[model samples]
Structure formats: structure tokens, C-alpha cells
Target: MPEKLPVYRIPDFTPAKALSRGIHVADLQAHRQKHAFVQAPHKHDFYLLLVVRNGQGTHTIDFTLYDVKPGSVFFLTPGQVHAWDLSPETEGTLLFFTPEFYRGNREADALRQFPFFQTWQHPPVFNVQPNSLSPVEQLLHQMQQEYSRAAPFQIDALRAYLELLLIQLARLYPKTTVASEENIWPFQLYQLETLVENHYLEHLPTSFYAHALHLSPKYLNELCKQNLGKTTTDLLQERLILEAKRLLTHSPHLNIAQVAQALGFEDNSYFGRFFKKQAEITPEQFRQKR
Candidate 1:
């Protein structure tokens, strides 16, 4: 049997009850003092941000190890498995908030506007130069201070600070070592990814994504080809296959038919054929190996 993955509900930490109010902040040092375990694999019900101001270790997310150093930032979207890799002396700020927090108290903005928030398509780690992180640090410090105090309109203040942090990080994202192809996806591709994120379960066709992005299927294919060396259908299948793999690997109680139904396939036999075509194995076989 596969090891059961640990899934955490909202407010993973003791102080995270504050997260229910919209935003919460904690220091790594305080966390270590409160709990005997410093690092264990876990997933969150909300988004998470960690900025390592002075640290040297590895932060692993979804089986990928990202080097942790001063000015390193980690972004974790909901459902991502992550673990801390730091020492007792390591120091950093951890922030948690839900999607509702983003839409509350202001005009709604798409979380997808930031690169790091798009964790499925992008690496969740960013290595910012120390000299360039002063403003970012100032914003985080203000958020921490506000979260700790009884200031009026506290959620408002936290929201402003969080928005600033996201904007600053988004600006730095394009300058990072992301693959050249990632930078070239174009606005249309960005919209396509957003669409897939929302509607992949519908089992929609490439034309649906093309129409939503207001491009013809040919142009969509062209854009994908130019940026990712893949066609629109290929990209869409990649997203669908990814979700299928997630269900197959994690939802052990679900039978193959249930997995098919959950992913919008009505026919178990059809789903089996589709999975085999894309994954080169039966869903059961894939789950066993994983």
C-alpha cells in the first residue's frame, strides 16, 4: 500500500485561527519554539508564502527541491504538498490567507496575475537578490507588525500589504531564471492556462479554450507551437492528464470508474483507453508504481 499523504485543513498552525479572519503571519523561530517538529510534509487548504531572510537549507515542494537562502521566497497554492528544510536558527516570515481574502474588502483581482501563484505551471521558488529585496522586506515587515497588533481596519491593512507583496514578486518573477519558453507564452497562453485551471474538469475541447481566449484553434495551436513546441490539444491533454494522475495517485479509495466519473468521463472503458494512451499504463498500474 502507498503511504497516505497528510492533508491539512485551513489554519494548519496553532496561530492560524487568525487566518480565518483573512490573513495571518508567523515567524519560523516562533513556530520552532511552539512545536517539536520543525519539518514534516503537509498540504494546505489556503495559499502560503514564505520568505527566508537568513537561511540555508532546502525547501521541497511536490518532490522538487528548491534551495533556500537569504531572499528566497516560496509560494504554495492550495493542495500543493510542501515541507520546510531549515534549522533551529533559521529565520523567515510565513504568511497564510485564503482566496476569499483576496476578494474581500476591495475589488476582486485574479490571483493568477502573479507567476508564483500559478504554481502548477511555474516553479514555486524565487531567489531574489539581497540588494533588491528591501522594499519586499519592508512590506512583509509591515504586514507582520499589523497582524500582531490591535490596529483598526486590520484586515484592510493586511490586504494592502499583501497586494503590494504580490505585485513586487510578480515584477521580480519575469526577471528570474524561468525557462525562456515560459516568458514567451504570450497573453493568449496565459488566458488559456487560466481557462484550463478553471474548466479542465469539464473535459472541454481545444476549440473551447480557443474561443474563450478569442483565438481560432489554428492561432491557438500556433501560439502553443511557438512558445512550447506543442499544439493546443497537446497542452490541454497535458492539463487533463495531470489532474487524472492526481486523482489516481492520491484518492486510493476511489475505484477506476469513480476516478473516471470524477474527472468527467462517463465511461470507464473510455477513461481506461484515454489514460493508457496518455500515460502508457493503466490507471491502476500507474497508482501502484507511484
Candidate 2:
């Protein structure tokens, strides 16, 4: 087995500090071989997309693992926990950009309107069709050429290409069919979900929200699962783990015990195992490096 590594940020494929402009591009031809180890759950300030050209692997985003095979494509939005488990032989192209790359652009606002940008009970995982891969390949190839352009309009030109790429992917997104109703999709029920996201830290169980929403647990779960693809417990647990990762990676003051208590875990051992089950890394190890 490969030696286990402590949690750490994957080094910038090309050092960010070295770039003079707002964007830089590189073709990560050897990413899979070098990045085979499981990265501790963490988020980034920028956005990235990994296009898998060969091999198969799994990617973890927000506590959900999606199977990735040849021709698969994955997107990482800003500030989402993600890690990859790759075979040593995996090969792909990685695209990275700062938020500025999309800033002040109308398409950026439209792109954010996609449902995948929401807190889905499951991360969006789209299986790439064999035919769709060619456009992605062409986009990457075009992007590589644009990166080396010496023209005065390079930033605007690159942004236009980038917008086109997002538009194509957005078009590919499968639209959810909704049936019209008077109290359609239950707007009030969705308000309850927002309540859960904002205040799950109280460690309130399903009943608590049911009471607040004036609905039975059975009703709430059925409604939430229909729209969000998960039961209330799943959403709560995912949010708890998300916060745990934040505390683990972003905070330096708390040790494992303190962290567990702060997150409402009364038993330290159980908390450790629970975190490992969700994140595939023990809290102590996750906190030590990244």
C-alpha cells in the first residue's frame, strides 16, 4: 500500500503566485498518476473542471462519491469539499480559474442559476456521452492555444471562450420536470429547508423541524426526498459533516475532542469513526496538515 499522507492541499498545478494575469491554464496530462492518494475533504476559492480522458476513478464532493470513468466530466464550484481517488494510470485535463475569471459577466449569473449550484442532497454527477467528449476536447485544445496568445485582447478572448464552454455544459444539464399546482412545490416547505441549513447546529432532530413546519416526519421526508433526493436525516448528516470539515480544515484551536463536542458528538470514538466513514479520513489526520 502507498504510505498514507496527512491532509494537504494539492499544490497548484502551476503556481498561482507566478502568474501575472487574472487567469492561467495548464493541461494536467499526468494529474491522475501523481494525485492518486485520497485528498482530505476541503474547498477552494476558485472553480475547476476535470475531464477524464482515460482510466476510471471516484470523486468525492460534499460527502458524496461519484464514479468517474473515461470521458467523464466533473465540476467543482467555489467552496465545496472534494477529493479524488484515482488509479495511477489515470489521465485527464484540469481547468482552473479564479472567480475573477467569471466576474462582471452576465453568463456567470445565469450559470449560477443551475440547480447543481444549490445544496443538492447529492452532488450533480453527469455521465458524459461518447459524442459529447469531442466538444470538451476541442474546448480544452482551444483553451491551451489561447493561453499562449500574445494579442492585446487575450483576456476578453479567453473569457468569451470560457463563457461558450459554460453555455454548452449548461445546455447539457437535464431539466427537471415539474407539475404545476396551486401551492406548487410547496414554497413554505422549502423555507423549512432553509431553516434546517441555517440552524442544524442546534443538533435538532427530524421531529424538531417537523414541529416547526407543522408537518409529520413522514410528510416532511417524503416532500424533501422528492425534491432534494434525500431524507431529512441525510441532509442533516451531510451538513454536519460539512461543518466538521470546515472546523477541521479551517480552525486551528480545536483538537479532535473539542471538535466533536462542538459539533454535538458526545462520544469521541464515535465521532472519529463517523467522520472517517463520511470523509474517509480520521479527524486527527485530517486536521494535521491541510
Candidate 3:
């Protein structure tokens, strides 16, 4: 069998302190040298914010390729696959934090409130305009300093800076429809998305998630349509298709039948039909093309 895609935890990079804190910050070039394996496609259990001060190459998230240059900012949530190909001269900063660390004492789903963190809803990459780069650059520098220091309430200090950094990035995120705190739809949608993420592999029905969110199936569909331009079923199917693609692309040893079984489809033929309907190609064709 092909090796399982590596999933890294924050502690993997900073074994001493990250186990307890669930956060780590590093200078980009040194981080690249120290963890060269990161260049290979892998997943992370923690969230990642990579701010590129200067770089040249491509950062691939899921199947999308993003250009790397000065002021490029990328956000990655847990379980997403990503890899970067950067020049040796690349210099920047990387912040890795888990949802628990970012949430602290706030709402449990605090990190999901940001559009960038909603990987299903928005692309995870953006560029910082040079004119507006100072504040963001300064925030990253402050975070690095705070992370490196040995001081009282350091976690709290780091959390505060992280929150500020997220807010700053959210403001600059392009054409995002970030809802106000009082808005219920966005939070409800986020909750539904979270539920889907957890249960999609089970092939659960849309009503299952609707009931979990205390909303009727029809209203849930309406909310998804209004906000995401897709139905609840579409979200579930799209997620399945994405995972199918990932398996097809990364797990060369898994034959089509095994991939189908892995994805909760008992019938490999049915899985092939479903994939073609949603992805516009057969599993074999997709794998070969990839």
C-alpha cells in the first residue's frame, strides 16, 4: 500500500513547548531548512498561517496552485493537504496554532468564524498589497518575538496577537462576505459545514445535519443556497469528491475498488458512476490524468 499521507501536529516541529501550548512560530528560511519534509504534500492537525515576505515558487493547497511572492499570505485549516516549492532565498514567517489554542476561552468554533479558515467556502491564499504590508509584517514580527520570549502569561499575549493578526488579514481578504457577530446565518452555515466535515465519510443525509443544527431540512438547504450557492447535498458530495481526488492522486497503491471501499461505498461500480456524475470523469481517468 502507498504510505499514508503524513499528518503533522504542532509538537512535531516544536517538541519541547508546543505539546502544551499547541502553537509555534518560526522564521521561514530556518523553518524550511529544519523541516524540509514539509515541501512534500502533507496534512496538518493544526492551522497554519504562512506570510511570505519574499519568495518565488508555487504553493499548492488541495488541487489549487497559488503563486508565491513577496507579501503572499496563506491560511490552512486542519486536514487540508498542502505543499510548497520555494526558492532557497525565500524568507518570511510561519505561525502554527491549533483550534483549541486559538479558541482559548472563547466560543468553541471561534476559528471557524473567519472566512479564510472555512476552507470549503473560500480559497486559502491571498497577497498582501505592498502599501498595506507594514501592519501585517509588524504583527508577524511581534508574534515571533512573543513566541520566543519566556515571560508570564506568554500564552495570553500570543493569543492576543494572533487574534489581532487574524482580524487584520480578514480585513484584507478579497471580496469576502464576512457576516457580523449578530448574524445567525453564517454561524449556522459554519456549524453545518463542520458537521458535514465530520460525517461526510459516513454518507449521512442532509436532514441529519439539519436536525443536528436545530434547523429544518428545507431551511438548511435555503441557507446553503443563499450563502454558498450549493445545496447541503452538494456540499457533502463535493467533499466526497475532493477526498476521492486526494486518494486517487496520492495513494497510487490503492486500486479503484479499494478507494471506493475506503470512501464508504460498498459497490465499486456505483462509486465510479457517482464520481463521474460529480467530477465529470471516471476514477480511473481522474487518477491517470493526475
Candidate 4:
């Protein structure tokens, strides 16, 4: 039987450098291939825009899995855990860029206005119908060709083209208007939920957020339930449990107490009960079986 591949950070890009401003198109695809870049559920502090030209599989992001098909486009923002399970024959153009790329650009910010880019109550999935894909296909082909050309201002040209692509995406997406039926409280709660998920390692209590957001504990709970369908405590517990599971499955060498401490649990016994209650087994036993 083949052994399970250990989950680890995808190797940092080679040419062995970072993209301070922009990257060439071929380098982007080659980086995906060179890193054995079948990413396991992970998050980054940057934006990723992927246009699946030819591929079919599941792409998991932040506790959700999306179906991938030809011409499907997906947007991932910073601090969202995502993974791609693509066919060996998978073909796609994935652009990774910092939020700074779109800094001060109104049209680029407009892309974030869509619900598809938010921490959704439902999964974010889009399938391109035949009649609606010409613009995106045109953009992808143009990006590939422009990237290959040797010109003095090629990087600047790529940036302009990429921004134009983002603008088209904003137009193709449905807009969000502030309707009377929509509650602002839920939006606030979701924003808080994202903060906790992204920084739970800091091991903050609910009061910290309440204080930060200028609200009380009771009000926070109400808002969370209304917006995200979960209470504040429920969201915190879920985040902790998910991280625990990731460590158990990915970091096999770590023992039970080590795992507990890594998750900011000062009381080992309490951590065991908390995990067992959610998982129905003690951590050590859970690790052994899995």
C-alpha cells in the first residue's frame, strides 16, 4: 500500500524569490508544477485568482469544497484555508498576487463586493455557461501571449491587463445592494468570525473581540446566530477543533499533550475532554486509529 503523504507547507517558490510586484505568466504555471503543488488545505496572506481552463475535481477552501470544471473561475482571499485536488491532466491559469496589486484601484476593490468572495453561508461555486465565457477566455489567452513577449514594460502591461480582467469579473458577477431585508448585524458577526478563525492561535477569549468591536458578549452572540447560523462560542470551538484535526492528521510525530499545548490549551485534562466531546474519542486514541 502507498503511504499517506505528510501534510506540510508547500515549498516556497523557487527561482527562490518572492513576487514583490508581479510575476511572469509562465513562471506562475511552472511554479505550480515544480512545487509538486498539490496543495493540502492551507491558507495564504495573499489573493489567488484561478481560471480552470481544463480540469475537473474538487477544490476545498475554508471548510468548503467546490466542484471544478472547464472555464470555472474562483476567487480566494487572504487567510482562507484552501486545497486543490485536480486531475493529473489538470490545466489552469492561477494568478497569485498581493492585495497591494489592487491597492487604490476602485474597480479591483469592486471584486470584493460580491458575495462569492465573502465567507459564505453556502459554498462558492460558479460554472461557466457556453454563452458567457468569451471575455474570460480572451483575457486568459491575451495574458499568456503578452507574458511571453520580451518588452521593456511587459510587467506594467501585465498589471494593466490583469486589472482589466478583474474589472470584467466584477461586471460578470451579480452586485450586492444594501436591501432593507439584509441585517448589518450578521455582517459584523461574520467579520468577527473570520478574525477569530484567522488568529485563534493567539487564543483570545470572546471578551477580547467584544471589546475590540465595541459590543457586549450577549449582543455578539445574537449577531453571530443571525448572520452565520452559529454562536460565537460555537465558532471558536469549531476553529479550535479544525486546527486540532489538522495537526493530528498532518503532524503525526506530535503527542497528545503537545497537540493540546500547541492549540493554546493550558489545561491538558480540559483539552482532552473538549476534544473527546467533539470527536467522541480521546486525542491519543484518535491519533492511533487514524
Candidate 5:
């Protein structure tokens, strides 16, 4: 079997005390120099917001390759595998924080409110216009300064800046149907997406997620369709197919049957048929193409 992908937690890079508070800010190039291992494909347990002020390269996130350039901003949620190769001159800031840190005294679905952070709805990366990049750069620098000072109530100050930064970026993001005070359905949809992420490996049905959300399956499907233009089953199947592809492409040592079993498919043949139906390609073909 292929070795399991490395999963990094905030404590891996930050001091133990910061681990409790769950936030880290760093100079992008300096951080990269200090931790060369991050250049390899790996997963993180905390959320990451990386802003590239100047760079030239590629950042591959969950199999999608994005250009790494000036004004590029990348947001990564927990469990999304990514690796990047930036120029030696790359300059930017990286903000790492846990859900708990961002959600302190806020609603449970706070982080999900940002469209970019909702990977199911939008891509994880966006580029800021040079004219508009100044504000964002300032916010990042302010956060870095506050993080280094360790002043009293520093956590509160950092959290406030983080939210402001998210707000600024949201404005730059392509307009979409985002959660708002007048609408609770988007929040519910976010909850459902989160549930799917946590339970997709189990191959749970829509009814299971519906019950967990205290909504009927039919209504849940309606919510999904209205917000995401997809049914609950479609969401679940897509999540399964994404993970299957990830395993097939990254874990070359694992055969088809092993990948199927890893994804909770008891029968390799059945897994093959399911994969082809959803991905429109055989597992071997997909693996070879990748």
C-alpha cells in the first residue's frame, strides 16, 4: 500500500501556546525557506490563506493547476491536498488559523459564509486586481505585525483583522449567491456540504444527511438544487469521485481494488462501474491520464 498522505496540524509549525489559540501568520518566502517540506503534496487540518504578492509558478490544489502570480490569493480548507512551486523571488504572506479560532463566539457556520472558502461552490484561488491589491497587502501586513507582537488580547485583534480580510476578498470574488441575513438556506446548504465532507467516505445516503440536518430528504435536495444547482445525491457522488481520483492519481502503489476498498467499495467490480458512471472514465484510464 502507498504511504498515507501527511496531515499537518497548526502545532506542527507554530509554538505550543499558539496551538491553543490556533493562528499563525508568516512571511511567505521566509516560511517556505524554513519549511521546505511544504513543497511536497500534503494536507493540513487548519485553514490556510496564502496571498502571493509576486511569483511565477504553479500551485496545484486537489488536481487543479492554478497560475502562481502577483495578486494571486489561495484559500485552503482542511483536508484539501495542495503543493506549489513558486519562484525564489516569491513574496507574500500566509495566514493559518483553525476553525475554532475563526469561529470564536460566532455562529457555527461562520467560516462557511465566505464563498471562496466554500470549495464546493467556488474555486479556492482568485487573483486580485493590482489597483485593489494594496488594501489586501496592508491587511496581511497588519496581521503579521499583530501576530509577532503578542500583545494583550492579540487573539481578538487578529480575529477581527482576519474577518475584515475575508470581507475584502469576498467583495473581489465573483458575485454569487452567498449566505446573507435575509436567507438561512445558504447557511443550511453550507452545513450540508460540511456534513458531506465528513461523511462521504462512509457512503451515506441523502436521507442520512437530511436527518442529521433535521430536514426531510426532499427539502434538503430542494435546498441543494436551489443553491448549488445539484441534488444531494449528485453532491455525494461527486465527493466520492473526487476522492477516488485523488487516491488513484497520488497513490500509485495502490491497485484499483485497494483504492476501491479504501473508498468503502466492498466489491472492486462494482467500484469500477460506479467510478466510470460518475467520472465517465475507467479508474485505470483516469490514473494513466493523470
Candidate 6:
């Protein structure tokens, strides 16, 4: 049987009943004091920007452990399971906001361009240098202060500050070695990624995507390889594996075969092999491990 990971639907992001919106920022110590869920593996539906101003700890995100330090900043995406272990003396600031809160009505699709939100590949932790983090911390402090006020255009001010902070953080974020920009997608990798994201459950083939985009399969493959350093097939498989992992670990009611079929895999055995090949563990093992 698969393990049922603890799932948390924060009141701030719940849509059924109207909840207070906009940025929610507070001192980490204070937030911890009010909330008992500090060190539990759970997933939420809002963005979390954690700035560790002091002390040390370990943050477990999606089965990977990251050391937490004073100068580090962590960007956690929605639906990514994570938890934290920190000392009482640890002090910092935490900011949480919904996607609509930050972007307003602007339709902010480009937020994914940031490395941390590239969920398929990059680990969502940023260890900012002590010297370089001064500016970043300053911006976070400003945003926190602005969030406390009933001032007009408050959302505008907060959004502008958030955008600046994300841009600045991206600059300081260490580039990934495996996912380097090889040729810079001058073509349509983003479009291809969007198409895959929407239709990945259909188990569409690379040729189908190429045809939909009106490009030759060879050209699409080349574009994906140059931009993401992976062939089109690998890219699609990565998405499938990620979804399968999510369902397996988070949705324990779905058995192995059911999860495989949901991911558009026709043969359960083939799906298990493919998952183990990419994730280094069989589907059942992964579900139980989590």
C-alpha cells in the first residue's frame, strides 16, 4: 500500500470560503509560536519564501534534505511536499502569498522563468551569500512592512517589490550544472513545455506535439535538447515520472496500476520500469519510502 503523505490546504489559499488575501509575512519565530506545524511533511497551495536570518536547521523538500542557514533563502512552490527542523533560537522571516495575490490580473505566466519554479529539474533552495544577501533581506523586510498596512495601492506596492526581489534573487541563484542554458531557446521551448504540461496525462507522443506546433519532429527535438539539455522523449518522461511520484506518494488510494494508467501508461510493468529507471526506485518502493 502507498503511504498517504500529510496534505495541508492552508486557509489563506482556500477558495470555497472567502479568506484574507494578499501577502502574509511574519517573523519565523512568531509564526512558529502561533502554528504547531513546524516540522511535518505536508504540501500547500501557496508560495512560500523563507528567509533564514539567523540560526541553523534542515529543510526536507520532496525527499531531498537542504541545510538551512542564516543567509539562505528558500523558494517553495505549491504542491511540493516539504518540512523543516529548526532550533528554537532560529529567527527569520516567512512570506506566503497566492499566485493571484502577487500578480493581480496581469496573468503572470512568466513567473516560471525563474529557476526555482522550474519544478521538473531544479531544487527550490537558494543559499544566498552573507554579503550579497543584505540587499535581498532588505527587500524582504520592506515587503513585510508594506503588507501590514491598509494603505491604498498596497497590492501594487507589494507586487512591485516581490517582482524586484524575485529578479534579484534569480541573479544570485547559482546556475544548475545539469540544466545549463546550452543554446538559449530562440524558438518555442516554452510553448512546447506548456503543451506538455496540459496534455502530459494523455500520454501524447513527441511526434504529436511536433505536429501540433507545425514543426518537424527533428526540429522540435533539437530545440528541446539545446534549451533543456534533454531530448524530447526524456522531457516528456520526466514530467510523467514527476506526476506519477506525486500521485503515488500523495494519493495512496491509487494503486500502482491505477497510478500508472492515470499517467497515460498503457502497460503497468513498463511504467514501473520507466519510473525505476528515472527515479532509481520501483513505484511501490517509492510509494512506501515516502
Pitting candidate 2 against candidate 6, the one with the higher TM-score is 6
TM-score of 1: 0.78
Which residues of candidate 6, in runs, are more than 4 Å off? Answer: 1-10, 13-19, 175-187, 211-214, 288-290
TM-score of each: 0.78, 0.60, 0.94, 0.72, 0.92, 0.81
Q: For model 6, how does the per-residue alpha-carbon lDDT over 167-282 read when each residue is reduced to its tens digit?
A: 88888888652245764434366567667877888877799999988999999889877666789999888878877877886787888998888777789999989999999999
Per-residue error at 132 for model 5, in Å? Answer: 0.7
Give the CA lDDT, 0 to 100, for residue 51 in model 3.
Answer: 86
**Cα-based lDDT for every prediction:** 0.76, 0.67, 0.85, 0.65, 0.86, 0.77
Candidate maximizing TM-score? 3
Task: Tell me which of candidates 1 and 3 scores higher on TM-score.
Answer: 3
Total backbone collisions, model 1 = 0
What are the per-residue Cα lDDT tens digits for candidate 1 across 142-238?
8888877787888887888888898988777755434465354376766777677788878788889888888898988898887677788787777
RMSD after Cα superposition, model 4: 5.3
lDDT of 6 at 228: 66
**Model 4: which residue pairs collide?**
none
Tens digits of per-residue lDDT, candidate 4, 1-290, equal: 01132322212342333333344343334555776654665566566777776658888865567898886878876655678877767676766666565553444344344454554443355566634767876886787787666677666677788778877775665444221345443446555755785677777888888777789988987877776777888878878887787677656667777888889888889999999998898888877785
Give lDDT tens digits, candidate 3, residues 1-290.
23388889887887566434578988999998999999999999888999888768999999999999987888988888889999999888888898888878876767777778877677888876666778888988888887777888988898899899999888888754555556544678778777888889898888899999999999999999987789989999999999999999988888999999889999999999999999999999999898
**Stretches > 4 Å off in candidate 1:** 1-19, 32-42, 55-57, 84-88, 104-108, 129-132, 174-185
Task: Superpose all Cα atoms of candidate 2 onto the true structure and report the RMSD in Å to 1 decimal.
Answer: 7.6
RMSD in Å for all candidates: 4.1, 7.6, 2.1, 5.3, 2.3, 3.7
Q: Over the full model, what C-alpha lDDT does candidate 2 score relative to the true structure?
A: 0.67
Supply the TM-score for candidate 4: 0.72
Model 5 error, position 289 (Å): 2.5
lDDT of 3 at 134: 81
The candidate maximizing lDDT is 5
Q: Candidate 3 clashing pairs?
A: none
